[model samples]
Target chain A: MSSNTDFVLSIEDLTVSFDGFKAVDKLNLYVDKNEIRVVIGPNGAGKTTVLDLICGKTRATSGSIKFKDLELTRMSEHQIVRAGVGRKFQNPSIYENLTVFENLEISYPKGRSVFGALAFKRTAEVVARVEEIAREIMLDEFLGTEAGLLSHGQKQWLEIGMLLIQDPELLMLDEPVAGMSARERELTGQLLRRICTNRSVLVIEHDMEFVKNIAHKVTVLHQGKILKEGSMEMVQSDPKVIEVYLGH
Target chain B: MQVAMNKLFGGREGLVGLAILAALIFIIMPLTFDIFRLNLVGKYLTYAFVAIGLVLCWGYGGILSLGQGMFFGLGGYCMAMFLKLESSSPESTKIQSTPGIPDFMDWNQLTALPWFWEPFHSLSFSLVAVIAVPCIFAFIISVAMFKRRVGGVYFAIITQAIALILTILIIGQQGYTGGINGITDLRTLKGWDIRTDEAKYVLYFLNGALLIGCILVGRLIITSKLGRLLLAMRDREDRVRFSGYDVSSFKVFVFCVGAMMSAIGGAMFTLQVGFMSPSFVGIVPSIEMVIFAAVGGRMSLIGAVYGALIVNFAKTFFSESFPALWLFLMGGLFIAVVMLFPNGLAGIYTSYIKPRIDAWIQGRRGGGNLTPTVPAEPQDPVSPRTAERTPASAASRSLAAGIQSEPSRS
Candidate 1:
């Protein structure tokens, strides 16, 4: 646990339930800065629920969640966002009717102002930042296109780019490559690699290969509790993990 | 010609098409139509101002306001009161002898002009009143309703009831409000003879200018971030609520803006028509304003202009020609248009024109090859570094079917 000193996020026995049904039960996890930690679970095993709790979507019932030593359990969703925690929902939650560039513009913290967004002069640096991000994601050609016209894979990329522009310290994504094509998924894997050098990323993915490709560490959840937590290869070899994946 | 036609009717070409059409109306209507028709068109343009406001409120804010006509009436009354006093004053020489006090005020008997009406005696006061009164009413109502999150049919019902009550109150206060007969016989505006043909054209041009201004402002706001937020609210309101925006504040701002625009239309209506009445403030007129925005294409600014003209034209034609079945015709028009063209006339042009032209151009270049339309993913790509491990683990992988086969071997 010596490496835990560098941990940016610490979740101590967090529990979240809908009505009486516990979704995340006494979940304990820690994510170090600049690390890609993957959370994998069965359909109802509460992998997404954990991300939801972190992002302030589903409030934790009893456990404390802290980011950068700030208690996140009591903060509003937007407050969490403003506190440098960004989230991308499983279903893309972008303004569909707006152009792709406009969608990115909204995610920029400065443009949220009523007067600033309208009358604020676009500086060269901001323009470069937007262009740089767009090019990195291979979206330069589609910058002017309406976001609604994007394919599922493109939307996932765009959502990720949006978070990047927000410049959040912690980025939580739920199933980022669920609907992406094989080629797009490979590109996305590289894109995520580049991002991990800067920000702490927590991705909730079901794709084991993608997880193995990107995840530095993996956590397994079964029936609302953590089944195992270790390196991807080690957890993949664990008998409990094998039983959850293969059954009987 | 084909390109021009597509540009004119294309859905997103709201600003361009509206500019061209408005210019044509301002120029052509005066030449082809007589003095009366020209004046009528002037009044219609004023009504279009109200439609623009309604477009901002209901189209963007998702508030189904059915009482814009009430704001129109408020502005009309403000202007009418000023004109009434100037024309009917004993010191005036318009009539051979003094008309004494206005008929409504004389009937009240104890009149030295109500304290509220005193400020409206000045042209400046009336002008400010036109903007202020409606804004105040909108602010009060919106604050109360939106703060409580009372929306949907209840919002519509409440506004409609306000219109009905205002009309009855105006009509019942015969001495003060001029009763059901309403105020008429206004002869001049700041000494310009309103009856003159030249004056009529002046009013028409003034209205045309206002229409352009309204369109430009609406266009600017719609393209802004606030507009995007408004549209997003329509799609996923709870998401917006959690996004840290005060949804009610935005709603209130839009409502006040819309109400002020409607009030300006009312002031213009009074100047052009030389009258104001309880009938204009009633539920039916309020409903007509909603219909004007709805039939034109609820979401498009140009559609509001088109709706104003088409619905008003239908009203004039059917009322004069058929009279008995005019209401039925309007209702039928509403049903037919809503069913056939959900996006209204603007929707019709876009769906039938722009895509075809795009397809035809693509076809000519490729010589009949079908072009594959790929949905481009949004420009922002999710960083793969952020991928969390699938908690499904080896033991749980067998239970999930659709996702289990993906990327596990990578």
Candidate 2:
């Protein structure tokens, strides 16, 4: 992705500290429209903190976070979402008491009017959309199952589908495949590729192989700062990346 | 057909219908029986309305309010005070002669009704007063408390203090308030004779209608996006805050709604019992309301109604029959239910009754399989700071990814 490409989000000098411990420091990055950007880091390298800051989960200590020219640092998480940024927390947050289909329905931006959730009849389009998302995530068969009953990976997929239904312009996922089986991980990778076809995706993952599989560009974070930002090969060849992962 | 029927009769609709049915029986059975039975059922329906509010506040919203009785009392006293005034003629009556005044007010020798008591003379004013007073009180207190970010035990204690203060204030103002005997000798509602069976029936029907309206409103709100936000408030309040919801606003909304419902219940109680006193609006009544919901099931709306009816029925039964042991039995029952069925009577019935009924129809009945499954015990307590990082690891490895949410930091 070139600098001239329409960027969905730009983070400049983003600094977030917890109790004097700097978790994210002066980070600058931009996610180009319809591009897949992977953020890789060792534990405590502030990858999740970046996503958290973008989604308004954590207030940036000092920073400029712009999504399509709208300032996101001052907005609430839901407002950020409404402003077209969707996030999938590392751990699934689907309503357990609700059915799988109901979970997806709640996340649909247009389908959440007070009357709509309780009394609104599911249109054929809604049914089709839900089924389509479920089918893509291999969850079509489990539509009737309670979301509480889904496997770990399936829950993650359902959550991702939820974000998709919201139709956010930028999707930020934190360790989306953290606990998935190999098969489920591969499916998630494919799902990310499909999602990246339309909207910008900033994925934070610890797994280098997973990053290499889905990343169009990889940014390596070490000690709360971006150490490297380049193609997968370039980032993999970076000495800091090897030192953080293997040596120091 | 099966699914449709199941949906209709298996969930909230079914419970609400049952509540309406109980209300109907209360209204009609009085005609079939004597006024004594009529009054009893009428009073029960009033309590049922109170329980419905408790359901929303405690059961779903996860706020175990111990001050609902204060709100209830606010409404009750509003009505009772008005009724006392209406009953009192300009010329001193015989009841006023007792202790040289109405018994509770004898000490004060109150020659004139207080300025606050003047408007309550009209039935409409008193009726509106019942709902409004409690709501305003709740609105003010909740705003103060929630703004300071008080929650959990502190919230519960502050509410308890409010109830206590109101109770004491009412008790001390015997001249203005009815005090210990509260306000009794209520004869009519406005121009209509409350002694009439039709009058009692109207009150009963209104109670039923109000309950239904409340349930519907609660249903609409809880099932909406706001409901999700409320539930999220219970699970991850900070997350919800960061999600951009004004947490204080949501808390106040729930508190006001709960207070209004209790006030409505109190108004009904005054009409049914023809009296209201400080005792009814104290800590004991508040705790009883909580117990009613807890015994039914804290997480389920229908369970609150069931718990209210069952617990109240037991109170009526045991108090009359085994007076000395009634409290003992109530305590025992609470302990037993908490230990045996942490989810409460609803869970017990689900595990025990429904299965047995199904088995009997299938001709493979077994009553022994009724032990309720205990909800997973609270995960070993983790400090808030540690708790934050634990979700990353705990969720990274779990059989039940969806069920085991990290206990929220309040």
Candidate 3:
């Protein structure tokens, strides 16, 4: 119950049930500052549910999700975002109708309120920030392109760039490389490592090669409980993890 | 200065579109139409206010409200109440059992004016009520529904039900609301006879000016960051929410703005038409208002105005000649517009007419030059076949090339 914690996010006894069916049951997970933790498991392993709990998407039935010093369970989605937590959906969720620059500008962490957005001026500072994030995601030249027109991989990158603009303290991604080609996967790995320098990242992935390249640590989930948690090599070698997840 | 103007009015093209619409409403229509026709056009323009609001709400925000007529009715009734009270002075109603109350109240055996109607005696209060009452009502409805994440067809259905409820309530309260006939026989507005020809002309111009002003306000919102946000939210509501926006608040705000605009139109309707009725505040008229927006091109402000004017004109024309088949014709027209031109008249203009006009202008310039001019191909180096690709895909393919050329990480 201490207010102080070295970890960026701490979850203890987190449980979310849908009509008495517990999706995430008594899960205890901790993500440290500037760490990239990957959660990998079978289809119904509750990997997404854990991220949902952290970002206030799905309310927890019983538990505490402490993001820094704040209790995330009580806050709304936007409030959770403003408190410096960013989430990317399983599917690339960029605004298709908006241009790349606008997609980034909309997520620039300023003018977030209704009236603020109304009076928001597209100042040089905002343009510069948008350009910076666009270049980081390798989308600098495609600033004027509509987001919907981007290839699957580029759309994923744009979503990442959107979260990057917010500069959130804790970043969560669900299947960042689900539909990506090999080259797109490699570029995404490099992008993830580069962006994780100053923030904590929680990524859900089924691609072992991509996970090995970017994950600092790995947590294996089985039926809403963690079966193994360690370095990539450690989790990969764990007999229980191998039996429940990787063995198949 | 030029850049600022472009930003305010959605670029030079938008400004030109607006100017053309202004010329039609202010100069051409007034000059060509007789007083009777002009007054009718003014009435149609009042509905345009509701249509314009729908562009912001349903078109941009993706919130389709089928109860705009309720807000419009609220405004019209407010204005009508004021006028009716003015004309129903003690001298005018001396033969009635009660000399000071509205005639409808006297017939229903009510002694004094209802407490709510007492404020309508003050023109300023009634004028404010015309906008504020509908907005407050909209705020409540939107907060209750949007906060619960009730939207799309459910929201539309709920609004239709609310409009129906309001119509029934007005009809049931014959004493207070002047019954099904509505608040009619409105004679004056603060001693100025609104029924006079000069008053009608002034009211028409005022309605036109106010509509133009509303369009300008809408343009301002549409061109701002908020406008982009509305478009973004419409397509991807969760994306906007995750990006740190209170999505419901934006929905509520736009819905209120739409309500306020509809109320203004309703007030103008009362003034020009000299009455208010439940027929204009129910489900059918509300759907008709939505048709105006859809036919005009829901996304285009000026198009909605033209939509209202054109549809109403068609109605008048057809109803006059083919009175029995007018309803069938309207239904058929709506179906055709949806099937053939989903983007409505504005969409047709932009997709077909505007391009041809641009090409013709280019050809004229080319003809004047000594050298033969070739049409410029899209500047997409990545895709040589971009000349055949749609502009949207060409831009995206160029982006695909950018990603393909990225250096692979070791």
Candidate 4:
């Protein structure tokens, strides 16, 4: 991680404590360009907290989170997003009050100021771009649908589509398919594969089969520390990794 | 026909609202109402300004500013200061010890105008100050509160506390703010006596036109992408923050804009009513203004106007004829509105009336392809005369209005 300039993100000794329960303790992680990295863990293992720290939603006690050359821990959430990092919450957090087209259109990387938004129009290009993303997320026919009316799985996909609209170099998603059907999960796996060709994805997922299908490298987190970091097959073979994650 | 309708109303129900407002302002009120009653309507319209502002702030931004009265009083006092100074010409105030100063100043043993009162001597400065002062005050409050991420009920309470502070400050400093009487004896604006009936009529018309302009500006904002973002932020603020937008900046911007709108109403109130008082600058009136917005349909600009007119009209009618029952009626109205009509008049109109009209229009168009958007459920029991508010009805109705009609072309 130190020598490789190809790395898009590097976290050095990152730690966060909530009432003395170290949620993410001295966590060291790295993701290279175009890499698809998945952090697998049981509940309260701080998989989500790590994403929160990287996205500037949660402050680190004392650590450094560097995205490319920019320091993320010091920046605000909006600033981190502008610096080419996008995050999706564990729950489907897309704007339910807006339509699918609007959800995607708002996430588009232009006209961000108050005055800009006042004059922002649904031009031919914007309409086309929104439509393209809607199709990619399998929500083409539902573009006119209010996002609140979408199925649980559909909303999950819409959030991913919203993040994709920005064309961010790095995307962080929490529980991308927690409530998704097997069919939806398969589609999401395919979507992840396509997206990771040009960008990086740092995901927190529990589905081992889904992880095996999408992750180029896997990191297993247990009790605020990394238990194993390797390929799916390599990590699955590790006794310590199996003991915590595959205990069920 | 569609283009004409859109041009006239901005949308379906908006056109209906615009038509009624135009008729009321231009034809009905001018013909039917006497100067006194017309002036009363003008006063009520002033409250409509604050109500409309509340629609944007509370309804869309999900920020309930319980102290909008602070901005309202700020604007009103700014105008009153100017008018009070103009009326206190040396000749008119010769009986007072301080001939050139306002009577209140003389009563409170003041010999010269206060430092803050000097700027109002210039009409241009007064006019600018009326809008600018409130906006600046609102801007400072918004930046301090929103930047720190303080919101929801906490913001509302702080605003209410601020209203209480301002009221006390104005009343305590009798020498400056005129105490309980406020900045009264406002007889003129640039030497034209506002007390005359002709002057009242002129001011009423001017007030109506300015209100229409404010409503149009509000319409422009709510229909813009910025408006949609406001709705989005209300529902999912973190999503908006993560979308690379400064959430606090947007909150501050809307807050200031709402303040400016309330300020305009305040100035207009001072002009038509011939006085400004601390009665309208405290917690009671501030919350009452919010109730007006809530009653009118928080989401609809047109509804806000109707809300102000109706609530105020009822207040005056009940207070004059039934006197003792007015307070009871007001309390009941607030309770009924909160419990039954969460969306207010506009919500009822959209839920019950708008759907029927849509059906009629579709019937005329040889309707065959109406697909049910929601999973088929029994319609709520609705009385035709009253507003029927189901939480989802407003959302679905607006959705149907925007998207359902356009999908066919694609």
Question: Considering just chain B, what TM-score does every model have?
Answer: 0.83, 0.78, 0.90, 0.88
Better of 1 and 3 by TM-score: 3
Query: What lDDT, from 0 to 1, does candidate 4 have?
Result: 0.86
Docking class of 4: medium
True-structure RMSD, every candidate: 9.2, 8.2, 4.3, 5.1
Q: Candidates' interface RMSDs, in order?
A: 9.0, 11.4, 6.5, 9.1
- Model 3: per-residue lDDT, tens digit, B372-401? 222222222232111111222323344444
Better of 1 and 4 by lDDT: 4
Ranked by TM-score, the better of candidates 2 and 4 is 4
Task: Write model 1 residue lDDT over B96-212, tens digit each, in one string.
Answer: 322446756766663456677777669898888888988999899999998778887999999999999999999888878898988988888788788788988888888888887
lDDT at position A192, candidate 2: 90
By DockQ, who's the top model here? 3
DockQ of 3: 0.56
Off by over 4 Å in 2: A1-6, A111-121, A246-248, B1-33, B92-115, B139-155, B172-181, B195-255, B298-303, B320-328, B358-410
Note the Cα lDDT for every prediction shown: 0.76, 0.72, 0.88, 0.86
Per-residue lDDT of A1-248 in model 4, one digit per residue for the tens? 45345689999888999999999989899899999999998888999999999999999998888898888989999999998899989999998766677789889978788999887766778878888898989888777556766778889999999999999999998989898889989999998888777899999999888999999999999989998999999999999877887866
Q: Determine which window of 10 residues in candidate 1 chain B has minimal summed lDDT.
A: B387-396
Instruction: TM-score for candidate 4, please give it.
Output: 0.92
lDDT of 3 by residue, A59-176 (tens): 9999899998899999999999999999999999988766787789889888888899889987778888988998999988777765766788999999999999999989999999
- lDDT of residue B97 for candidate 1: 27
